[model samples]
Target chain A: MAHIVFEQVTKQYDNGFVAVKDLNLEIGDDEFLVLVGPSGCGKTTSLRMLAGLESISRGSLYIDGQRVNEKSPRERDIAMVFQSYALYPHMSVFENMAFGLQLQGTAKPEIQQRVQAAAAQLGIEELLDRKPKQLSGGQRQRVAVGRAIVRDPSAFLMDEPLSNLDAKLRVQARAELTKLHKKLGTTFIYVTHDQVEAMTMGSRIAVMNQGILQQVDTPQNLYEHPNNMFVAGFMGSPAMNFFEATLTQTGEQMVIDAGALQLPVPEEVRSRYQSLLGTPLIFGIRPENIYNPEFAPPGINPVAIEATVSVVEMMGHEEIVYFALGDGHEFLARVDPRSRFTPGESVSVSFDMNRFHLFDKASEHVLVS
Target chain B: MQDASNIMRLLGAIAAIIVGSGGIIALFYVANLVVNRLPPRPRSQILPWVYMVPALVMLGAFLVLPTLRTILLSFMDRRSQGWVGLDNYIFAFTNADMLIAFRNNVLWLVLVTGVSVGLGLVIAVLVDRVKYEPLAKALIFLPMAISFVGASVIWRFMYAYQPPGTDQIGLLNAIAVALGYEPIGWLVNKSVNNFALIAIMIWLQTGFAMVLLSSAVKGIPKDVIEAARIDGASEFQIFWRITIPMISSTIVVVSTTIIVLVLKVFDIVFVMTGGNLDTDVIASRMIKEMFNFRNFGRGSAIAVVLLLAVIPVMVTNIRRFQQQEANR
Candidate 1:
């Protein structure tokens, strides 16, 4: 087991295109740290670098407090599972799992025993003799994991290992991977572009964008308190909506001038910016934080605003109502299924002021991180 | 009576070849059985090499030992007694007749090997996804089925020349006359005769190259290529480190095949040009020295040079094949 640390690690291609930049992350031993981003966001590059597969263009990487910039993948004692599984086409499943051990010069009988043990753990003992082409996507994925497990390496690096499987199989594999991580008790640096996978599997998720590290935090922390406009917009489905407005401090109330609507800021947030008035700022609120005014529970003071319902999607348990604000800016509100809302109808919505995010217009950094 | 005697000679030659080949194979099989019967029972991998003993032995007897003897004999006089030093080699390099043969062989090697492999690669890539590829490949490959002598005879008729006027009997001169040009002797022109000879070689070897390279290209998987890069391989490293190793056996097979074939090629040049008018290759020159001029020293000297040239390429090919098999 190893604790991996990336101290300002960066990956830059020969053409001066930086895939990752100034990434400082510490993954503790036995911790599952996921690197998540969209395509071309350097998640896989970071993972491959950790696996000693890509050279660090700048900065240093440490595994268990030992600098390993010059170490090869074999010397690093790490096992990797590629997105396609990358099983040697000529080898049987058993041979595929035994290849690393054989390369390491592990004894023949021991290689077979470890391979069989891994295969049995994966419920693929009968598949040992079959080639990768004969197996289904999930089966191939398990073989890839088994190949890593058989190595008993210091860490396991997986690059979107479940992406090839179908939706149902992906869910099943995701659960199995989490269980595997716990059982092995080895550090796993998983890379994927799926936010759901990062949130569900990673004990800590590191969000990245355009070669820059955005945030490294727990899923609940990322959802509740985002650090910037990008993080606030990227964390949740339906995305957080942003509107340009100016904060104005009146005698006792801080009212937001949102073009055609005026909403009061909660007193606690108002006190933080009482001295600064008439400054333009970006207001962000998650879809779930806004509710149908009629169904919004009584007890706390709510900021009421009017909007024209554009579309209503019934999602079994809740209805996501897309609405256009008076100034033509659009956003969504997740309302109770019992609420009666339809397209082309104007409805009053209440923003949960306590749950909204505020950001500076110029810097785009969250004002309340 | 002469015909009966000739038939008997022919039968004897055929029988000798059959018995020689069968005896070598049986000898290797018995050796393999003996090795299998020995103690310390876990060396099964020696079995393949044991099976390889027949080919190795044949190569040693007919090719390697003869090459070594020729190199040794190249330093001696025709009687194989006096030390001639580099006399035969000097005659080979400086003599105008031998120089012409040397230049012609160079032309044949460059044109035949280069063009055959280049054109074969192009054709293989083009027909890779075509619907009637196998039919096209088979049709193109038909030349290989005909012996080089047979092909030379066929193309000889195609290039058959006649006198300027009286009925151009040859197909080429007939076409020339039809196209309103004077009849021309195709093989008599020193400037173009080498090319004409080289064309027959390229035609016969291109199909072999195409079949081997095509299969090698198809065997490479995209996943393995990407995995190679992900496993710390750069572009050139990926090419040399993974791609080459994967397809190396095919490359060595095709290249050595063409190289060895070209080194000893004589049937086409002998049949078509009779090794005259700048069309004489090393093989033809060697035969002319040994059989026609009765200069065994010169012929063996040329044979030694050819063998030496081919040995390096064969050694490199053997090493690559060994590496590939080891990885497997």
Candidate 2:
């Protein structure tokens, strides 16, 4: 078990391109921390710095409180599973898993025992003698994981290990990896650009953009209380919708004036934005927060607005409806599938007043998170 | 009578043409018919050899027969009149000039193969990471395009000697004279002539070795090397454990090819020094014995020795290829 820390770590290439900047992250022992971002977002660079694969340009890294900035990867005592499942093509599966142990000069009997236990754990016992090319992609993925397991290192670093598998196999492998993490209770730091994988597997997800950390929080917390516009839009599928609007105080309540529609904020949450009463702000709402009036759940403080339904997607349990307002502002809502809303029909949708988010227009930071 | 004889010759020509082309077709047709009439088990057993007959016949006539004749002549007199029974072999092994040839062949085998492959592997690894890799590889591999005799001629000018004289024209002598040292005769000096000849062969072959080895080095995936580093392998360990084994097959191919080429080394020695001044090798000596001295028995004996030396290298290479195919 290991607690890994990146203290203001920065990576700058020789050509003056900064791949990662001022990354500060603390991963506790036995925690499955996922570094999630889009392509070229520096998540992989940060992970590589921690793995000692890439050099840390400006700041220090610590593993169990040891400064390992100058240490080589071999001295770091961490194992990584590459996205390609980089098994040695010339070696048998057994030898592939035993390679690290052999390098460390582990006893023959112990190496054999550890390798067998790992293979049995991964349910790949029958594939011990087969070469890497002889195995299917999913089997190779397991062998890559099994190779890391045999090392019994303090941490496991996985760089998009499931991205190469087919869709169905990726889902299956995702669950198996989570179960394995829980069984081993080792610190797992996984890097991927897939948000769904991040949400499903990470104990806590760290989101990054443009070489900077945007937010680090639990999956539920990140969805319910995102810190900025990027996080709110990035975390959920179909994304959160935003409207350019102004907030005004009316008597004792606050109202959002979004040009096309106006809705009063809930009395309980009104005081959170009273100081910015007449300032232009951005209003945000997730797809799930908007609902069809007929099937809107009770006690959500629903405020009704009229719009024309442009398209409807029936998803068995719910419908994803695209709505266009009178001012041409468009948004989507996940409503109850039983409500038969169709295209070209005027429908009244309810916005949960308590769940709406307000952000400062200039900074795009949450005004009332 | 003349017209009658001409008519008869034309008829005979027609008969010969018919027998030549039609005979082969008819023979194959009848053999196919006979094989089709047999049971399936015997038919399957006989079919492959039937298909192999033409190639096997050609090999037997061209290769097998000549080799047997050469062996037979090795035991006979110079004119192949009577059985001399190992006298030529005794002369080949015991002669003073033949001993020098044997020693020089061994030197070529060891030094030329080792230096060429070693230099090729080192250059391949270092050049792969550079930005101007293609240009650098092209420059290094350009020497392979030159034939051995052409390369020897180029080096001959480089090694030309000018007897401690005024304004030496040879490149080496000019450098020595410019440095205030006496001009040295490179080819005439027995000590340096063999080495000079070997250097020419190395120059021609290192490029061939480099092209093969560079591709082999590049064939290893980058991730495998990175994984080795993360698995706690030092750089040296990674090279030994991952890089070497990954390119072992290519290395074997390059080495055996160089060995075969080095064993039959004749062109450079013949072009540069004509095997004089203690620079004789097996192939050049065999040629001299056969053509210049008209000693067929001694030449055949030397040829048998060269064949014996090369057989194991070829056999090992074939086995390696078969193993790789089986794995695939």
Q: Please, what is the whole-model Cα lDDT of each candidate in the order they appear?
A: 0.83, 0.92
Task: State residue B192's C-alpha deviation in candidate 2, in Å.
Answer: 5.9
TM-score of chain B of each: 0.76, 0.84
**Which portions of model 2 show Cα errors greater than 4 Å?**
A249-253, B1-103, B130-139, B154-195, B294-328
Whole-structure CA lDDT of model 2: 0.92
Candidate 2 local lDDT, A163-228, one digit each (tens): 999999999999999999999999999999999999999999999998999999999999889999
Off by over 4 Å in 1: A297-301, B1-328
> Residue A63: error of model 2 in Å?
2.1
The CAPRI-style docking tier of model 1 reads: incorrect
Docking class of 2: medium
| Model 1 agreement with the true structure over B203-302: per-residue lDDT tens digits | 9989888887778867887656545443344555545545555665776678777888898898898999889887888889989988898888888898
Q: Per-residue lDDT tens digits of candidate 2, residues B111-191? A: 899999989988888788889999998998998999998998999899988666567888988988899899888888999
